[model samples]
Target: MPPTVGERAPDFESLLCTGETFRSTRLDEALDGGCVLVFSAFSFSAIAENWWKRYERAGWADFDVPVLGVTRDGPYAQNAFLRYLESPFRLFSDVDGRVGEAYDLLVEREGMANTTTSWRAVFVLDADRTVTYAWVADDWISPVPREEVEEAVAQL
Candidate 1:
């Protein structure tokens, strides 16, 4: 199971597309701001492209809060998809699937190898880095609705 509401989110360092990095812990001295994190199977997948495009068109990207996504793909895939969409959003690569496993979203499906990817999921972390919301898919087929995710983030 994923971390539940009111729980402390695990601290993680991710390799971003820019060759820089992002860390999630919100310590008093940390510069990394809080954000709503979304974990997807792959950034360049057709379903992910459509899902994010629709979310962007709806103006949800301008929500008065930080929002980002995590994907199993590496920096190369993310960089290509970022250009293809030209969206300002950045996707942090969980190429090793460590973050997904920590969040309890990595599992072995019927035919897929264990720890190979993450299920589609969404998480809202407050400015203090506590989880305000969490949603994990039972499987990786359907898209997670952006409106529902925005609703959860709005609560913070």
Candidate 2:
């Protein structure tokens, strides 16, 4: 199961894509005022593209807290995805799915044998890395509860 509200988020280190370059990042070190972590199966897919576009339209970039995306794609693909979206935030490359496993978001893809990916989910973390809000999609394509997430971050 995924972390719930008030639970401490699992700390993780992964390759971070800054749209222009790649670097190592740890969850604990990235915390500031707080942050939003978005998990998806992969980058460059139709569903993933649309999901990020929705976030962009929702003004997620202007939130008081930083918003970061995590996916199993490598840094190269992540960089291209960020550039494609013209995103203001960075993305973590969970290439080995270790971060996904740590967060309990790893799952085998339906109808695809031997393939695994992170489920679509959103988490709002406070400065201390405690989960203030958490949402995991029941299915692959469900949209994130943006208003609820925004409220959670605002309260933090």
Candidate 3:
């Protein structure tokens, strides 16, 4: 199961894609006032593209907290995806799925033997790394609850 509200979020270290380059980032070190952590399957999928576009249109960058994305894709693919979207937020490369596993977001799709991907999920964390809010998609393509996330950030 995933971390619940009021619980300390699992800390992780991964390669962060900054559009131009990659850098090692630790979850605890990245926290400022608060942050929204997004976990998704593939960076290049249509669903993922639409997800990022939706956030862009919703003015997600204007929120009080920083938003970060994570996927199992390599840093190279993540860099390209971030560049292509012209996204304001950075993406972390969880290539080994260790981050996903730590967050309990890893899922094995039906009919895809030995293949595991991070489930679509979002976590709002305070500077102390405590989870303020958590949401996991019921299915692969469910849309993120942007308004709720915005409200959560506003409370930070």
Candidate 4:
């Protein structure tokens, strides 16, 4: 299950990509002195791509804190989406789904054999690694609303 409000957010290490830069990043370090929105999505979904594309086009959601995206896709796919969408946030590759498993956000889809992908989810956490807001998808779409995320960070 995702960490509930007021619970300590799970710490994870993964490959993060920002613009053309890639690095091994830790969740706790991203949360230092600010907050991070752990955004999970399927790499190939039109809805996911379009929505994130809009966010990128608008150049919004650039709050004081950082919003990091996570997915089971590797750096190549992650960076491809980043390049295509021009997103303001960096994306971290949870290639083995370790981060997804930590948050219980993995979804096994049919026809994928034994492979699984991350369901859409959002977690806003503070510098101390405490979750301030959490939203897990009920279906293939409907990730957390952007307004809610902005409001969450505005209060921070």
Of candidate 1, the 10-residue stretch with the lowest lDDT total is 23-32
Give Cα-based local distance difference scores for all models: 0.72, 0.91, 0.90, 0.76
Number of backbone clashes in candidate 1: 0
- Candidate 4: the clashing residue pairs are none
lDDT of 4 by residue, 9-114 (tens): 8888999987577889898877745575555556656977876776555444566777788888888888877777766778889899899888877888878888
Prediction 3 global C-alpha lDDT: 0.90
TM-score of every model? 0.82, 0.97, 0.96, 0.89
Give candidate 1's root-mean-square deviation (CA, Å): 3.3
Q: Which stretches of candidate 2 lie over 4 Å from their true place?
A: none
Error of 2 at 53 (Å): 1.0
Candidate 1 lDDT by residue in tens digits, 117-149: 778888877877788788888766676766777
Q: Which stretches of candidate 3 lie over 4 Å from their true place?
A: none
Candidate 1, superposed: residue stretches over 4 Å from native: 18-33, 109-115
Question: In what order do the candidates fall by TM-score, top score first?
Answer: 2, 3, 4, 1
| TM-score of candidate 4 relative to the true fold | 0.89
Per-residue CA lDDT of candidate 3, range 34-142, in tens? 8999999999899999999899899987777778999989999999999999888889999999999998888897898988998899999999989999999989988
Model 2: per-residue lDDT, tens digit, 1-156?
A: 899998999999999888999989898877778999999998999999998888888988888888899999999999999999898878999999999999999999988898899889999999988999999998998779999998998898
- State how far residue 8 of model 4 sits from its true place (Å): 0.6
